[model samples]
Target: MGEPSVDNMFSTASNKPHSRRKRMLSNVYSKSHIMANEALKAQISTIIYDRFLPYLASTFDDTPPTTTTEQPQTQPGGGGVFNICALLSATTMDIVTGYIFGLNASSNLIDNREELAWFLDLYNSRRSFNFWPQEFPRFTAFVERWMPGYRLSPKWVDEANGEIEKWTADMCERADAQVSSAGAVGGEEKAECVPVVYQQLWKALSKEAKGEEESGGTLSQQLRMSLASEVLDHLAAGFDTSGITLTYIVHELSQHPDIQSRLQKELLTLSPRLVPSSAPAAIPDPKAVDALPVLHAVIWETLRLHSAIPGPQPRFTPAQGCRLGPEEKSYYVPGGVRVSASAGLLHLNEEVYERASEWRPERWLDMDRLDVEKKKDMESRWFWAFGSGGRMCIGSHLAVYQMKYIVAALYSNYSTTIVDDTDIEQSDAYTAPPKSDKLMIKLIKAYT
Candidate 1:
């Protein structure tokens, strides 16, 4: 046995000329692929200086609102007062979908109990069947379609996939229709539709469909399906990461009222933006909320401590054993062995962090004071909140932006006091979420 070829497995096939159209199609739906790569650089410039900072400054108000505390104790055999896991899942879905589709799809578990339950049920069902179809593709495919007692039958998986695909396609269709209608309505009467990646993707696919080469297959079906999967990946990754980060941030803030107060004070500076207003203008600019130091540090610390996807990011070792780490020492990792590292373990290294296990945002502030060599070690070897190299999270920046906004919005406008504190530990999985399903917190409105 030899190391599996690391060709298309890791690389984005969108680079080739033949596949350029497909790449373009992907860009239409993939913010990571299109907007982040080309548009974000320029678009960020417009928002970063002009709109972002001002929005952050507006979140703070003169007088903060007082919240009433009601702590819920675990009833012997009854369910815990707060299900942190479920809360996290709802938060993730809202933030991710909100960013990608410009829809406030988050069930806001704090308010809508029934919707939260429905969402968590669907989410768990999908999670239980994920690895089988993704990892052992051939076997799972065979068993699903033909074999009996396949716990998650092929029928169920297909139904789930179909439902998801239909949802995505509907979004894509609506976006496309809006774009076309806007184009038809000449002059300045055009309205900007929601910022969905699907709009761009449909445009690219349409172009490819019209200019199909003699031997090439139809772009309408294959391209659409491929892009659909890519969108699903973004939805799954975006929601899961942001949700986990939010849950941890809430947990930590609940435990440390002083830090929470400091954060609220910072948020208060944002004034009208912090005030809950129905107008779109009232919503703080995304870029500005992203730049708050305390907010950034809180999110960073949460990501470092409870990395959502912290398992082994395995890569098949090269046939000619390659040198890894700063030492450049060659280690013969057998060709087929899954060589990888874990952010969960790496983030806890004492060499990089003084109180490695402790949650301390101050450490990030003083990182510059450390010795150059020490700082280099931290940057190179220890920090891996996002996986390294090409496969690194494409949505890292987006995730950060969304998490900061959610935290800022919550803490700036209201105070969060934990209703229940017991069993706050996280589950051990690819998306290591809180073990408990509820996170009951009293939200006291802040007064301007």
Candidate 2:
């Protein structure tokens, strides 16, 4: 309710503080580090092989298995239509929390359908209420404290925050326990048992943190709250953003069978294709996955068309005055001015991107034909899915890893048919998902 303390790296104002916070865990978020992280690898393997694939193999999970009322012929599988949107959300939450608190202690939302449903229900409900408290906290607080019965958000909003905060606190405590008992033998623990980010942040804060008054809590207490604040944001973005992107990727690929087939072929080229049986113990080389041109194109094209955070990323102009716009007609603007740019608008620029509104992965693949400047403009300058500069999404590499792996696993083993995509168009919001918030798909298992 109070807006998790601004100490989280993304919301912090000054560059100095933000950089310091980032330095605490930047190394591990690097692609090299994520690929090599034993915990992540083990957890991902379990999620795909043990959890996800089995769930899909069930063909369909028709609740009640029978109904007197007529049901839509969403899929022929007969089990029932699956809400891929909810599944993707659950998958992301599991993976991100696993990375944060270690898989042993992280959520089993992927396996617990009921809990997964509950979590998403609570989480998505609050998205609409974030406007007041997030953008104008002081005003929101004033209304609540003075204007009796006049609240910007409902009571359930605070209740949802409390539930999520409690969940995060439990994970933080588990991470603390693991760190306290860690020793040489800790390395022998299960690969996914190591809480990497939590351990790093606690160690850094323990050494540097000196006073209780700064955050109105003792050193260890303050550190725990800070850890909760930071990781919660990371967990939210790490899952939601990637989940949205992957959902759109699946939706698009299903609509374009040829493109989906081509991407699957590309995924299969890896030494260990994500097929569960063929390579039970075979995890594809991260480098190989990263190198797949078609896979890259699909992801990039989806990001271009459906950026999760399609809204503006606001930035304050520097303290020193600077020119505002076009060099020829630019006028000086004072510092601290709120300036913003929209990834959604940039990606739709027709001059920079031919047939800008179309979902053409070829645009990325065909970039070699363009001159360097044009290529840069099309690919780098306009693309802002993860924002830019020091404040960019820190877990971006991990998000990419999870999305790519999940996609590879899915298409490698099954062909998806879009069952019902009514209201699939994205909502007009910062972290936009389909306004309908559901994507029914039929999973046709594939084999050689």
Candidate 3:
């Protein structure tokens, strides 16, 4: 929320400016585009097969701790015990960055633990200080400037932010080079490595900025920063939210092995099963994976129960004001008043979702069995994970696409059991992550 510029769609408060910016690249993140983009498909396949799976496989060599004390022991086979939450974060980071900047230019976090740990440390450490700056920007600024002895946010926060900005700016530069170059990188692998989101926005902005040099528009500098800001927002939100959801999916599935088994069976039905092979794994068609009801239910239920952004999303009332509450209790709200909703509370409505406190994926699967009104309520009315209406998440389709594929690929081969869930509770932040930021799990091969 401590945004440096309001040019990014997320930070742009006014409807007109946000909508205009959203219009430029909304189609790229559309469901149809995400499902059918060959470049995206290739990018997913490369990440899952070449990076994520291999990293999981490398965990086989690890020796898990056996006791709370000094003694350590090896399991019968080997130690595939590792922090899957961190791995999921890394994978999502890679996927989002690849989609934004191209596979060739993206972070290799999945295969590079040192960098992953470093980046995660920098990113996650800033969470505790967010409240001061995000919720009280003016007071935070005043304290930092007038009362330097009592800085609201630490100096290192700025350093961490600077590093992240520089990192994103570097990717933007690489993407710009990719755009300005005469021809594409020559190779079968790099052929499908096009920066889909970046290219679309870059082309649109360039056309919009055309012939502005005569007017002293300074289009180049402004355009570069604007693009970087937007894409950086996209990358951060895309990775963090999806990673949190996927981690919970694995946790819930591990606790309910029967459901996990059912999911695995469905995953096996894919023509090219997402299993490890001597040859590159044939990543299943995302459409096929999407159609699996149980898989869909798992994802939906996880999203419902463990909404990444469970905090208030504030919106101002219309200038003309509007009615509030049920018909019996309806009252007129004053114009220009700030109002908000929380997905966490909305999803827990017992009337909308029976056993609302439970993690029952079957609730999503059996929605059609409910009464007409109940089914409607369950389907879309109560589902606010991605928010609703004009300003809803533009990356929802892409998020679902990557998550489905990642889940399908992982569960198709290994069965997960929680190694430790000491502090696995969801945090109370605006964008909630696991309290401990760790979910260690042991992955056993479903077959051998």
Error of 2 at 157 (Å): 0.3
lDDT value, candidate 1, whole model: 0.56
- TM-score of every model versus the real structure: 0.73, 0.91, 0.91
The digit string of per-residue lDDT tens for model 3 on 374-433 reads: 877887889899999977999999999999989988898799999888889999898899
Model 3 worst lDDT window (10 residues)? 65-74
lDDT of 1 at 360: 82
lDDT of 2 by residue, 206-323 (tens): 6677632221222455567787888888888888998899899999999999998998778778877787775566678777887788888899899999999997888888999688
On lDDT, the candidate that comes out on top is 3
Sorted by TM-score, highest first, which candidate order results?
Answer: 2, 3, 1
lDDT (C-alpha, whole model) for all candidates = 0.56, 0.80, 0.83
- Model 1, 182-251: lDDT tens per residue? 4422323212223345545545556656753322233455555655555566777777777877878888
Mark the regions of model 3 whose C-alpha exceeds 4 Å error after superposition: 1-6, 62-78, 138-150, 184-189, 211-219, 278-280
Decoy 2 TM-score against native? 0.91
In TM-score terms, candidate 1 sits at 0.73
